[model samples]
Target: MTSFTRPFILAAALATLPLTALADPSVAPAKDSLEIDEPGGVPAGYVLKWSDEFDKPGLPDPKLWAYDTKANKHGWANEERQYYSLARRENSRVEDGQLIIEARKEDLKNKPDWGGQHYTSARLLSKNSYQYGYIEVRAQLPCGLGVWPAIWQLPTTDHMMWPDDGEIDIMEYVGWDQDTIYHTVHTGLYNHVKHTQKGVLKHMPAVCGQWHTYSLTWTPDEIREGIDGRDYFRFVNEHTGKGAWPFDRPNHLILNLAVGGTFGGKTGVDDSTMPWQFRIDYVRVYQKPE
Candidate 1:
């Protein structure tokens, strides 16, 4: 989940917010922006703050989602071969009550933004940001070599600068390593580059063919990662300094299916799996009342 490159540009509107406003994750959005529907099964003490069921049949709701194509032209941080398309339905679309992020074997040399990549896929960022909250996503993974799917969060700041700003990888999976999943946290003092990241690995045999819920519960005290309501990993706040604990500030969500990256392509891509679909059922975030 630690991209070798710096974070890409987020929404222009988010970048213009005052630092004070951006720093406070407790600052609520307009009440009307809270929910599309009152989601059920929420924990007793937490209230549903935001959600996207992907019930609408079309591109993801623009108000709730934005594309990440800034790194495509120069290739992605991990030498990913996919050219993440911008607002292209072929790469990302909603249908049959699911968000389908498809990775296809193709070239977009004709497009002005095409980055000379052999594959095309999608990377989406949540328009909203959160501080301490419980975030969950239900989805079925795509299988076969070279497929890299991830659900993660990054600092929501225009000045975001890699590990220093911190990253929370709620879930990450590579095709070659079927049924295995990873949950990791990166900060200035701990990261993969330094071989000191806080991470967990789990094996779930039904990971690719079944729908599973991956989640992150974050608080001022610690961050926990879980699958199907069962917690398997936890990173506690040491209260040492920002270098070790930067989760106090707001971070936005990210959903992407990358193909042929430094990690995903360790065994090379399988062309037969030309069009692989990464299906997402829903994304919901909840926060305890202050």
Candidate 2:
């Protein structure tokens, strides 16, 4: 039952935001940028709220992870190719002080198989939800022409339904864009439609298969996305209005690795590709005094 729906084209105006392209030679496909960028960390005053150090090695931490077996096809933005299964080892597991979401290159001839995608991986979601604050997750990405890994959060409001329920894709990458990373937000305004807005940051640094701490700081005033402490993009909630600021509720976390789909086609995926994996050192969250 897990399937992918058509991608909603984001509005050209939102794509035009200054971060549309990252031009740093270190992270960008080619070096090009004028502003001098500096490094930053968890904003001052924020304290460690919650964390999963991955101390054990057999099945994921029950306190933090749960199987997402929803049968309805996920919009699966960007041509990502992945099918999430409930009890399959190929899809997820905890190992060696870390979490692994394995992506296999083969034919999936079973349940929830979209039919076309031959790769299987895990998309684990946190049953726990945090209302608002700074969230930090440290993990190394799996890099290959077709590998896609992400550490993001979503609203707990299944009651409101999707889109309106909202989603925050803090860190998402397709194997092809090895060095560069993408941070996105999907609300009612930009939920899988041609009229959505998105901001992309490029030319940061290498994050594939290496440890890097990714963070998201959400406040009533703004939403900021950072990599290893350095901020790449900020969305001003006040300037964007309520439609773009539906992040006012508790949002859960998700860690997943996907293969070629929408953005996957650009990089191309060969079923002969053997196996790929997504590694997570641990996940931690923080909340400031309310």
Candidate 3:
């Protein structure tokens, strides 16, 4: 389920540090020449339409990102335990040329909708949206039980609720299942709750410690997902109607690190693994040449 919700009742806390403290001066700037090991270069006809190399350090480019600060005591749907922070750098930051989203064990007892959750993290959404394109995210995942990190997409408009509008999960990892990564798609007619969602799991032993390119190529007829340029899953439109294919409209990107939730906490959380991090080196979107 989507982690978007409204604030609940809780007292406001005192002000915290400014955003400047989020930058890490010790980490040298990333070299612009750093290269990823994608299987091949851009496909023959696609053109780069947008990209965020995260070359700059600080809060994420304001022009490109917006925070998902909705707080719910019950984890927004999957029984998550993080209070998505919009004012704290302890949860989200840009450093050493990468976007770092961290989940820490700490309770903001006074914050609105504070439900005594002992963790805090960040969720970011791309301001821009597109109908169909080749989307790629280069990242090093976080590990340890209870950590659920994801790179996914959702419809840009609220014309319909989740599942009805569509959801594309390029990559989803649960620390307990440290060796497997999931690629899934949810629609009204096909969803996990109904036991009919379209998905696949790929085994990659070193996923947490190394950087990998997770990608999704969406077109009018189908959606394909992969890692390091090798596609492992494909879902095609069945022409059965919108219930099964709600991807025709523009969809925006979401990057988040959730803690101790339905899937991630199935094996139960190792609170000792309190603080975890998810890092993204770059995100790029390309469109087919007309």
The candidate scoring highest on TM-score is 1
Candidate 2, residue 158: how far the Cα is off, in Å: 2.1
Q: How much is the lDDT of residue 149 in candidate 2?
A: 71
Error of 3 at 225 (Å): 0.2
lDDT of each: 0.77, 0.62, 0.73
Q: CA RMSD for every model?
A: 9.8, 8.3, 10.6
RMSD of 3: 10.6
lDDT of 2 by residue, 32-111 (tens): 21122346567777777667888887778766677654421442434445666666766677777877888886556656
- Summing lDDT over every window of 10 consecutive residues in candidate 2, give the lowest-scoring window: 17-26
Stretches of candidate 2 off by over 4 Å are: 1-39, 72-80, 107-117, 160-162, 190-192, 239-241
What is the overall TM-score of model 3 with all chains considered together? 0.84
Candidate 1 collision pairs? none
lDDT of 1 by residue, 91-177 (tens): 999999999999999999998878799899998888878877789999999988988888988887777666777888888888888
Worst 10 residues of 1 by lDDT: 17-26
Model 2, residue 123: C-alpha shift (Å):
0.6
- What TM-scores do the predictions have? 0.86, 0.78, 0.84
